[model samples]
Target chain A: MSEIACVECGAEIRLDEDVIQNEILPCPDCGVELEVMSLDPVQLALAPEVEEDWGE
Target chain B: MTRVAMVITRVRAEEKMLLEVFRQRGTDPELIRDEELVINPSVIDPRWDEFDIVLQRSLSTSRGLYLLELFDAWGVPTVNSLRTASICSDKFKTSLALAKAGVPQPEVRIAFTPQSALEAVTELGYPAVLKPMIGSWGRLLAKVSDADAAEAVLEHRQTLGNYPYHVHFVQSYVEKPRGRDIRAFVVAGETICAIYRSSSHWVTNTARGASVEQCPVTAELQDLCRRASEAVGGGVLAMDVFETEGGFVLNEINHTMEFRNSIEPTGVDIAGRIVDYALALAAQLERGEGE
Candidate 1:
């Protein structure tokens, strides 16, 4: 997972295993919208760092 | 020659206006009921080449997600897309997104259980408003002005049983203009039009017997609305904002909203404007695809 393009804006975005698993990135060029996983584990790496802040 | 399929409930005033716009543009459009969709990722068949864009209409958050996933799998472009829509559809998620984006939204809590709701009420204090997470038309809206009332509402919810859809959205009910709320229609980066919605009841939704009033779009309100839309990943959005003593607090951000009634007074062809902006986004996607 080196670089991926945004589905909406098509800006080249570099991805890390960490960020990819975490499902987060910013279009360094377009500065609009994000490409998040509709479902996960597409490439099947170790799961992204999970955020643990769930409550009402 | 792009066909645009609108995922809507039923063809109503706003939907009719959008269809007219599609016809005016010489674009083929189809109206599909949201409930008809069955979500599956393997069968990604949308006749993608035939349709250039999908416009999501006013649908519940749950059904809206199903349609979003359906389109996503088929690789069709969508207005308000699915990611933003999914976030905005849930009141809790919407507030969290706004707060994360540094946009001003009222504090909110999600109560999955009745006992949790009681505890949340105790902590958040009274005069809080309780609503379902995925709700439209302001249905099941209750303002618990006191502890006893809050307990009663909680008990009622308890009696309703373990309904998964029984998720509650508890918000600090700002003493907004007695049954009045401001709705700002945003297209792209601009606030296309703004209106004031009022009702005799506490919940001021047009669907809840609220009347549309002309709210002067002051620069302050305009800026707030614009910022709110931008914060939530811009496209076409109808932001429901409330005026509070401190300033303005965002009530809700609806990606696929209805505004036919309010737009005429503002002299903006909201339906046309939204279509135009969506076309621009589709064009953007195409250009991106080509690159």
Candidate 2:
């Protein structure tokens, strides 16, 4: 399993062994939504805010 | 069980709805991510042929189209056929098809250059609309109220310097009741239901916060929707219409449409109807109806 240091509360986050890019996770301590922006060397960033959209 | 494969990029509300319906119906449907899909000519995956049908639900227009094309080439019956997706994806082709089928739609003109586009707008009269030839969610749509606005929009398109941008898609704006437009969902040659999308703004796309309400599915609307579907090669479609003082004018048809809000308003099982349609197509394919 891969580990990530949460950018929010610095909590250690263990990603799924087969975690794919763009998989979203929440910070354990602060609960900030994190998106796996990159896979190699595993970088996480704040998930982009998704606006509530009505049916198109 | 009707074996099905759904091509999707993201699991949005619509996908979730369809997946639930499929599960309830005892379908062991496979969810294929669009990002990981590719056309491998050298070693074609024979596994794709196992499914009776494939459903295209990619949020991106280009990806949906290309994936549908590949599915078609593999002899897999797709929910909305490749022909329907391509024609509806391009606004100009859609207008031609609808016009040829005698479906009343907004007057649209295609100009290769900014100069001709401006001239076409002038001929259409003031307050004309300009839109991108290929897009959805009402993006890149400009309401050119006058010559100045038209020139500015044209100049901006020119500045973009892209080939597709140069081909200006100018349209005549229809006068509808303030903040109201009709969106009717069609599935497999049936006009399921019609919803009035209302908002305070000119564009009444639901994605733009337009509220939706049930509109009576009158015979006239049913007939019009059927004709519109046939005009665009017939499949699952959503028709954007304008109820004007004159009458109902068809605006555009969406192949892979979004209809989360239409469910409550229409009281029709939109996802169920779509799955049923796909199963029917799969049956036909199994019977060798169309290769």
Candidate 3:
């Protein structure tokens, strides 16, 4: 899946990988037809380790 | 009694024609100004359910949509039906339906907020058209040649009225149609007539001072209109077609269409067809048996 901003409403939409490359997707927010582009999926960044877990 | 309900504007030639046709066929049509009758929202709850077949021609006001939906749920038949009419009223919905059905339409996007409107112009680039989602007859359509001008127009529009809460349809501007665009009338998936609308202005809508002339209906144009109508579901439709840089693009589809003096040239008895079609459908439903 790739996240694309709605060209009409600017709402972020997660288009399916296949739909992004081939099909047009309507913005869930505004119902505008958008041409979905293929983009590299962003990997989630890891959170920093807490200094103290002993207290818990 | 063959109960026929006509939802239309106050009174016009088209409405008169429809009434005349119904009368000639011995059917009295009840004229209902669906928008004007809305004294209270709840008033619609009762009268809406009594109609057998609802037909609408001109509904310019935004409030007309409420009536469209009311008739939709009222469990009756309409000329174009509510779903098709509703989609045709909104350009954004029309484009989405067309694209999904694989009908050729210009690349388009809609904008709700001011921010997105700017971005849409940016992405679509210059030389595009910005139109209201639920507009008709070529009102409030602006063709922008550059991004700066497009942004200014959007900014001006935002401040001119209450900000629109949703995105309207925006699309790339098609090349001027050698001074003419095509309007094809389709009924039950069949092409009834096709006419070329010409105007000096870029907006070639008949409502916007365009002149209609008979155009030879090519096989390709017929197929395009048919595909566009079928893609968005069947209806008594008016499909606006134009050739764009990309190719033949379906500009828009009108469900509740108005065919006035323009039909005189086509030699198509539009009023007769509409009335006959309704009567035939009503009969086919097996609901009217000399009642």
Q: Please give the range of 10 consecutive residues that has the lowest summed lDDT in model 1 chain B.
A: B40-49
* Pairs with backbone N, CA or C atoms under 3 Å apart (clashes), candidate 1: A21-A48
Per-residue lDDT of B38-157 in model 3, one digit per residue for the tens?
455445556556666777654553445566666666566677666777677767778888888889987798878767877887798778888766666776788999878877778777
Q: In Å, what is the interface RMSD of model 2?
A: 6.3
Q: What is the alpha-carbon interface RMSD for each candidate?
A: 14.5, 6.3, 27.6
**DockQ score of candidate 2?**
0.13
- lDDT by residue (B163-213, candidate 1, tens digit) is 744677788877666768888887875877788888777788876668887
- What DockQ does every candidate get? 0.01, 0.13, 0.01
- Worst-scoring 10-residue span by lDDT in model 2 chain B: B35-44
Q: Per-residue CA lDDT of candidate 2, range B13-125, in tens?
A: 67777877888888868878777866785564788878888988877787788778787787778878899988998889999999999999988899998899999999999
Interface RMSD (Å) of model 3? 27.6
Span of 10 residues, lowest total lDDT, candidate 3 chain B: B34-43
Maximum-lDDT candidate? 2
